[model samples]
Target: MNEPGGSGGAEGVRLQKVLAGAGLGSRRACEELIAQGRVQVDGEVVREQGMRVDPTTVVLHVDGMRVQLDPDLVTIALHKPKGVVSSMHDEKGRPDLSGLVADRRVFHVGRLDADSEGLLLLTNDGELAHRLAHPSYEVTKTYVVTVEGRVKPGVGQALKRGIELDDGPVRVDAYTVLETSPRRSLVQVDLHEGRNRIVRRMFDAVGHPVTRLVRTRIGPVRLGQLKPGQTRVVAGNELGALMAAVDL
Candidate 1:
């Protein structure tokens, strides 16, 4: 394992690298912290990126808040209920995940629209969050969608084949019809795309506008019996699977 500072020694690690490893953000973003003079070493503001200090011995602070190396990498699964935004704050006074989880430092891995609900992963591990959110990883996300009108046979195939939206072409890896009725139909669609409202828009593009959307799974983790407005820690083999999915 790499030490907090590259190779433990009298000289500390690079400030930006230390900050990034601490889950603050990417190295470039951490560099901005140093440039903004918000980073401090031993109570002195450090605007230079080259400056290094031992995390164990030297006192470090950012924006007047003490910066400590978080030893525990926390990741939690939240069954976000509808009407709750995926963000930490909503300027319009809408509910958000911050209220559900005690740790405000952790952020949602991806986003579920305010109107959509289901399994949402929140974590303080910035690197893991970045890998999971990136399109290249192709992390599978399964959704249980309820659409208006009974979906025709060809619709599922069409979705699997691919559809061109305003942004670009989108397609589902798998499509399954779980239930069907004259007025409504329930379908399970699996895809790796993480665009905003991609599932809803995909069905809408196929002329079957979605009535309700709920994410059932992400990678190896499932929503399972988790009820609305509930959260649980992701650990054990489940967390291991998630880490494996992203090649962590």
Candidate 2:
């Protein structure tokens, strides 16, 4: 990453990356903006996608409006309650994350289903969010799952081995029996896959439907004692560990 523009003589970062990190959209979209001559650097119309600029010192404008680099990145850990939609808005008028956080600009890093509840990271730092959501980073997410019935002996091992889902093959990084009863079993599972409704579907595929699910951890960040419908800023070593997880 290029150092923030200063007299230290650091080279400027790629224009598209700077624009994308500023929440302009994807790098591709930012490239399009540059190609269309909508972006200007230091009063010069920059059409070249490879052009780099110092975000801290260089003046950037898109569509004639000044583009300000976000000086302080805000990341929040939210314990999303059940029945709340993961999106900013729901067509059905269902409750969403927007109600919990006053700022509509910050977006959820990854999604939890309406029926699922757990630690959901919301942030204005699009680049970090992109890295976390991307499967290549292999950020492990740990979950405590409650299934409808006692999992059979081989089931846990099977999940650890691998399972063929509709999208592709997936396997848990770790799996352990937390508690088991005749009617229900609580199991802790860790996986890097971020497919939609994966935890519930994984158990459902194994003939044991999920009764309840809660994500306990994402990378090194834990949900801890955060209550449902509550939000808190991620800070200190916890935030540092998360950024390090994605090589940010």
The predictions' CA RMSDs to the true structure, in order, are 11.7, 11.4
lDDT of each: 0.84, 0.85
Candidate 2 error regions (>4 Å): 1-71
TM-score of 1: 0.72
Top-lDDT candidate index: 2
Output candidate 1 Cα RMSD: 11.7
**Compared with the true structure, what per-residue lDDT tens digits does model 2 show for residues 109-220?**
8899999999999998888899999989999999999998888999989999999989888899999999999999999999998999999889999999998999989998
Task: Give the alpha carbon lDDT tens digit for every residue of 6-42 in model 1.
Answer: 3345467787888887766899999998999887776
| Residue runs of model 1 more than 4 Å from their true location after superposition | 1-71
Query: Pairing residues by index, what is the TM-score of model 2?
Result: 0.73
